[model samples]
Target: MTRLLVVDDSALMRRLLGELFTHAGGFEIAFARDGLDALRQLHEFQPDVVTLDVHMPKLDGLRCLDRIMVERPCPVVMVSAMTAEGAEATLEALSLGAVDFIAKPGGAISLKMDLFGPTLVEKVQAAARARLPKARRLAERLRLHRAEPRPRLRPPPMRPAPAAPVGLPDLPPLPALPGEIEGAVVVGCSTGGPPALDALLAPLPADFPWPILVAQHMPASFTGPLARRLDKLCALTVREVTHPVPLAPGHVYIARGEADLIVGRRPAGLMALPAPAQAEHRWHPSTDRLVTSAMEPVGARRLVGILMTGMGNDGAAAMTVLRQAGGRTIAEAEETAVVWGMPGELVRNGGAEFVVPLDGIAACLLDLVPAR
Candidate 1:
């Protein structure tokens, strides 16, 4: 049985979580009413995984999580609200080494159980199997995050590509034609995506000459804050694609949460547009969809696919296609990924041209895509 420690201040929530896990089976569970109690339980139970609530009495989630990472260094999943504040707090928790997170169901909690229970059970199971990231690499990433910005060259002018043809919709189900783009980068990540994204994008200079399109699995509320946070830290301009915006050098387009972001030719230039998530795709802002769509507008030769730190094989198949079609692909090394499912699949399928660690991914990208 997998040992699980459920930490929440609410008696009702604790009970509900207990019942949910009990029904799911395969778990030897223990409950803690607050962060202080959780700390005690952590020592006593020595659980394989912990589901920690962000808001708790005696000690808040962030502080308690900080201590837990230092002392025990086990996999911890954050249970957070789906509000703006909750999103920010949850992102912070992820940076502090939480493996993954699930949004707390609010309003008519009992009614939401059917939708919540399975996801909770799934995350806990994943957490139980997750590997603790190496502290040295994590420290290096944090150090880079706090490092001063590097000097940037002025970005050269982008040559104009003919706009999308008339009678075509702005957002198409599929990319119209193979664009003649100079070069572009498509990134896919989940699980420990945010912090990994930080380490990847922070090291690039402001004038790095490839447009980066990212498909990160997250809720609607979280992606916006994530973009804002990344924009603040990264030298590159990072924005969530809510509308049809032309892709340009030194810019990073974050796919809107719950929507798949695809690149399509428009009257202006190559634009990043959010399309409705395809049912065939299992994860939201599907990486496979994003990669395939980009492969259409931006051919395999001019494109680079990166798979990093996510659970499941979301980008493996598409990236394999990209590599076989003569595109470059990078997969994060298993030693660095919290859940190696995504990138590991790429390697297993013989897709990745480069298998690098989280600390070295930015350097790899820089080496692959030269500055203008």
Candidate 2:
């Protein structure tokens, strides 16, 4: 049976969570009033998973998380309020070593209780079953102690070679078609995509002409936070998209967990499409489904496909179909990618016509989009 430890300062929250987990069964449950109490319980209960609250009395969640990582090392799911400060703290907790987090519902004790009751149980169950790798655990521990200071080292001296301006082979310019390209921009990314995405979207002018659809492999709970975080950093509007919303240009849509993002045409206009049933893919927000379904309404002429860094060839097959349909394709160059697997496959298989580093992707995209 799974063993769980629920830690929170609020007595009501503890009671509600305890009741929820108890009803969900197949496990043992322990309750702690605060982070310190939780740490005390850890010594006795040795829980399989821990549900931690960020703003607890005595010891804060991040400190508790540090102790747990160094001492017992159980999977921890942070419970945080939905406020911006709470979100920031929760992310810090994740960076500190917590596996994941669930935002507490509005301020009401009862509503919050009802909201988190089910999700809390589910996260605990999932956490209990997860087997963290030793290397990952060690890395997390090191990350906690290390101050992420910027590198100060200068580049090594190099022999002077060329005197002339360096000129790379220019990629074939995008064609000027008879009609306007009329559909969404679908992007598939994983692994090293976070920083890459920021770099790519930062340079996009405010009036970018198409709705951007993205399938980024991430946990469900992290998607919303990730979207919000990206929204702050990006020039375009970014949000976690739901099913049945129409596609609109100048906005960016990020696929939510377990949701397949598609594009469809309705009587009114073009809109975002979501599949009702869950599909099989190694990653949630599967790039294969996103890229393939995006081709439906947009067809070849209206699509722009980009495959970014990832471990598998999920988007390669879909990119081929898009390529055959005359959709534009861009793949990240191997040198700039964190894991070259996904984009590498596209390059090797002749799916991508253009290959560029992460830094230049935004400029390349701007060049592709026709002037409005």
Candidate 3:
């Protein structure tokens, strides 16, 4: 059985989570009433995964998560409230190595929490399978998080079109395309996406002249908080895009986790057209639809489409579309991706022009955009 430790301060929430996962079967559940209790349980139970609540008496989720990463190093999923503070804590937890998040409505635990049983189960299972960071890599990533203003650049490259890492597949060589590099950038990612987003986004400078749009698989409650978190770290401005706001250069617009962020031109300027979620998309805030929508709206100008770490081929085909339209394309290299599905499929299907490591993607992106 996959051993799981569900940690929250509320007894009712603990019971609700326990009942749901127990009924869901497949899991051997253990519970903790608060952060201090959760740490004790972590040592005794040594669960394969942990579902952590953001706030708690005595220890709190952030401190507990830090210790777990240092001592045990298992996948931890954060259970957070939909409010801004909860969102901020959740983002911090992800940076600290938590695999994913579950956003609950804030204020007292209620029966309403049970509605997320299926999602909770699904995420926990994913967490169990996710790769945990080693002590050294974890240190390195955190060091970068605290690094100087200049974005970290990848070490010098040997093979321009490099050989794949030992265990990963040998990708086909991409044929070179047009040399001119003036255009917007669109990114689509999911699954083990947050850390990868940080790897790529945090390094770019504030005056990164082109407009960028990202459609990350997330919920309505989480996107704004994520944008706020990233904006604080990134040199470039980040905003949680809502409604028909006009798009501008040098800023980033993160699509609502639940709504698709579409792009088009208006008499005034380029604009964001976030539409209602469509049932057919499977993943809310579909990256494919967003890219396809932009093809018409952005006109003849070329664009850069990036397919990062994710579970499915959500952005693969659309990335191909962007590449065909005189745009450049990149995928997170197999070695660095937590789940290689999206970027892997993109490379196999010949959609990616560059397959760079996670830390290297920011450099590649800046390379594609010339100073205005």
Candidate 4:
């Protein structure tokens, strides 16, 4: 049985989550009232997974998570509200090392449990199986556990990439304006996507030759904050695709949450547009639809399909088609993935041309796309 620790400030929430997971079966459930209580039980219960609330009286969720990651790194799935504050906190939690999160529904939570319960249980189960990496440096670990933490969810300042190692080629600086669109890179990720995106995009130069389009599974309130956070961290310009935007070589377009991002041809040039999620697509900002639409406008050879850490097989079929049609495809290797469901499926389907770890994806892209 999977061991689960449900941490919340409210007694009602604790009881509801306990009942919900209990009904889901195959779970040994435990509860904690606040962050302090959660930390104590962390040792006693030794849970395989933890469902953490964002707000608590004595110690908030973020601080508790910091300690958990440094002391005993277990898979943690945050229980967040749907508000903007909740979105910001949850994103920080993901960055700090929590595997995934679920939005906490307001109102009589029990009444909404029929709809919400299944998703919560699903995330917890997935978190239980997630891989936690032990490769963090001692200093970085100390920073996270430091007594005086930085302001909550503060975005990292933008910084340029370090000099390339000897014998390695450095990325060419951004070319002069009026550079025509050559091709586009379409990326898809879900679970564990935020930090993975940081690792993938942070290493690229501000003047990367091709535009990057990202479809990360998230809600309407969360995507905007996520885009802003990423923009602050990376040298590249990143923004949500709220309207039809002309594709630019150096910018990164993030698909609006709860909608599908598709590519089409306009009189001016290739455009990334937001549209309602089609009934056929199982997930919003569907990666399959994104890749297929790009193929029509840009042609497969000009396109690159990058499938990263996520759950289920959302992009596997379309990326397979992309590879067969001469498009380059990259899958995040199983060794570094939190849950190898999405990228692993692509590999099994014979879609990916290169299987790389999380950190090497940027370099791999540089090698594939020419600066000239």
TM-score of each: 0.89, 0.57, 0.85, 0.89
Task: Please list the C-alpha lDDT of all candidates, in the order they appear.
Answer: 0.84, 0.70, 0.77, 0.84
lDDT of 1: 0.84
lDDT assessment of candidate 4: 0.84
Model 4 bad stretches (over 4 Å): 135-178
Clash list (residue pairs), candidate 3 = 206-235
Per-residue C-alpha lDDT of model 3 across residues 177-276, encoded as one tens digit per residue: 3432235788988876777777778778776666789999988888987887777667778898887887766688999988998888788767888899
Best by TM-score: 4
lDDT of 4 by residue, 186-303 (tens): 9999999988887788777778788899999998888998888888767789999999999998799999888999999999999999999899998878999999999988988788
* Candidate 3, residue 339: lDDT: 70
Off by over 4 Å in 3: 106-114, 134-152, 156-182, 299-301
Per-residue C-alpha lDDT of model 2 across residues 156-202, encoded as one tens digit per residue: 22121122112323234345444444655778886545545655665
Tens-place lDDT digits, model 1, residues 1-372: 999999998888888889999999999999998888888999999999999999988899988998898888899999999999999999888878899999987797777888998988998898888887544356544653574443322222221112212232222112213343477899999998998898788778887777999999999889999998888777899999999899988899999998999988877778899999989999988999999998877788788889998888999999988877778788888888889999999888878877888777787777667555
Residue 270's C-alpha lDDT in candidate 3? 75
Model 4: lowest-lDDT 10 consecutive positions: 157-166
Answer with 1 or 4, whichever has the higher TM-score.
4
Compare candidates 1 and 3 on lDDT and give the better one.
1
| TM-score-better candidate, 1 vs 2 | 1
The TM-score, computed over Cα atoms with residue i paired to residue i, of candidate 2 is 0.57
